[model samples]
Target chain A: MEAFITYTLFAMLVATALAAVQLNRLFAVVMLSGVFSLLSAVLFVVLDAPDVAFTEAAVGAGISTVLMLGTLALTSRTEKSSSRSSAIPLLVVIVTGIVLVYGTLDMPNFGSANTPANTHIAAQFIEKTPHQIDVPNIVTAILASYRGYDTLGEVVVVFTAGIGVLLLIGRLGRRGERQKQIGRGE
Target chain B: MFVVAAIAVIVAMLLVLVRLYAGPTLYDRVLAVNVFGTHTVLLIGVVGFLTGRPDFLDIALLYALINFVGTIAVLKYFRYRAIGDVSASSVKREKAR
Candidate 1:
């Protein structure tokens, strides 16, 4: 059963990746990228990294897609044929793919309870968190406490992005002649 | 069950990608992306369950909020641009002081 599930997720990841590459419309590409992110989040869950899975889902599928779509709306929808050349990006992709696959070769087996990841910090958290935090979810305790600083950094980063987008959109709002008129009149 | 669903979602995503590729208009692409985003939110939740880590729910919630905000913002920006374009040439014909 587990094998079937793993295979299915792996297939989903591959399909979404293909979809992301195949889509030409900028919006569609962004959306497909969201799908790819969600699938990756699911894969994280299946791999027993719920915290990472959550982060993937939120940042990957959510905010990133939003940002991409915002950029798309501000730009051209149809992809420029000239921009689709299979030159440097393809070479980079191939090299990165090879490197990634090679790196995966040495990783622990899926769902192995005794994997190094499960034994180290995770075990410590699982064993000690309940007594410390009185929370049923050890992962929560770890996120809100054990690695609280990282989470705080993430929040700050998100805040910065929001500010950046606001600045960008806000500036666009003020550049028109009407805006200039209002500015002059006021 | 979760895996099966994951496969189904992925297949759907692929089909959506094809639609994106064939999109004749920007709106169609945006719609496809919106759909993709929703699916991803669900996928994350499911993944959390599969991995025995419920803390991921917080992240999923954050994603949902951000995705909605982003889509609205994009749509608004386009509308604003369209409005700006129209007003740019209209010249506000009036005799008011």
Candidate 2:
């Protein structure tokens, strides 16, 4: 039953991704990406990583969608048809995908307890989280305490991204006036 | 029972994806995405119960809130061509004049 649910979710995810790729309308593509994010979030849940799922849903489905729409507003609604041939890119993508699948072929089976990931620091973190962090959620404990520096780096990355977006598209005081001038010129 | 509920939600999600993919208008795609988000929230909750970790409900609740805000943001963007403030654009226009 669990396998059935997982397989269905993954299949839907692929379908949404393919649709997003095929669509030329920017609005529909944005919407499809949002659907893709939501589907992946559900997949994370099925994989027993609710914390990752939560972040994916909030950041992927929510904030990124809004940001993309904002970008869409500044750009054209439909994608321009490129005169360049797609053969090379398609070949590159297929080769990269094949390499990725080949790499994964040697990995342990899903949910195998004896896998290196499950047996490595994961066990130690799970064992010590309660005693050290005293947090009920081990995932949170590890993210916040055990890997505090990594989390801090993640936060800094997000802050830098926000600042970059603000600098780029955010209406600085004079820019708004300039935009109005452009509007008037049009 | 939890598995049954999860399966149902997944099936509904598939239908929503179809609408999101094939919707004739932008509004249909928006609606389909919104409905898909909702289904995701439900699936998270159901899967939490299936796995015997009810704590996952918090994630579901968070997803529901984010989904609502995202839908509102999309609709606002469609209506005003901006998600921030409509009055700001008006003020700019007036200043331009």
Candidate 3:
């Protein structure tokens, strides 16, 4: 049943992604991408990674959709017709996708216990998290304590991105004034 | 039983995605996305029970909150062309005078 759910969700995700790519309306594309993110988040849960799913749900479906819409509001609603040929891009994408699939051929099966990821520090983290961090949730303990610096780096990156966005698009209040001044000078 | 519920939710989500992909109007797409978000929250809860870790409910709750806020932001953007205060433009016009 779990495998069934996983496969179904994966199929739906691919379909939605294809639809998003084929759509020319920017608004529909943004909305379809939101659907894509939601589908992938559910897939994450099925794959037993709720924490990653949480971030994907919040950032992908929530923040990115809004950001894309904001961009659309400032730009064109429909995609412009491009004169450039798509043949090279399609060939490149297919080649890259084939290579990616080939790369995944060597990975261990999903949920395999003896896989390096499950055999390595993951076991130690699971074993020691309770005694060392005294946290009920091992994932949280590992993220907040064991991998403290990594979490801090993630936070710093998010902060920097927020600041950059603000610097670029946070001038709404001043923009009106600037336009008025230009009108007066003219 | 939980698997059954999860499967049902996934089917519903598939239907919602169809609407989201094929909706004739922007509002239809927005509504479809909102419904899809709701289905995700339900699926999360069901899968949490199915997997025997009810703690996933916390993530579902957070998802619900963010989904609501995002839908409102999109609707507001469509209605006013901005997500901030609707009166900001009027205030700017007054200041320009």
DockQ of each: 0.34, 0.77, 0.71
The collision pairs in model 1 are: A31-B33
Model 3 chain B is weakest, by summed lDDT over 10 consecutive residues, at: B82-91
Off by over 4 Å in 3: A126-160, A171-177, A180-186, B1-4, B90-97
List, residue by residue over A1-186, the lDDT tens digit for candidate 2. 778888888888888888888999989999988888888888898888877887898889888999899888776899998999999999999999999999999999988999987888888887888888899998788779878999999999999999998888876534765887798795
Q: What fraction of the native alpha-carbon contacts across the interface, defined at 8 angstroms, is recovered by model 2?
A: 0.91
Once fitted onto the true fold, the runs of candidate 2 whose alpha carbons sit more than 4 angstroms away are: A126-141, A144-149, A171-177, A181-186, B1-3, B88-97
lDDT over C-alpha atoms for residue B70 of model 1: 60
- Using TM-score as the yardstick, the better of models 2 and 3 is 2
TM-score of structure candidate 2:
0.85
Candidate 1 lDDT, tens digit per residue, B1-97? Answer: 7767755765676676666567777687677766766766676666556656666676667667766866675575455443223453334432221
Model 3, position A178, has a per-residue lDDT of 81
In model 1, the Cα lDDT at residue B91 comes to: 40
lDDT of 1 by residue, A87-149 (tens): 888899899999999999998876687887877977787788889889898768878988899
Root-mean-square deviation of each candidate, in angstroms? 6.3, 3.7, 3.8
Order candidates by lDDT, high to low. 3, 2, 1
lDDT of 3 at B4: 81
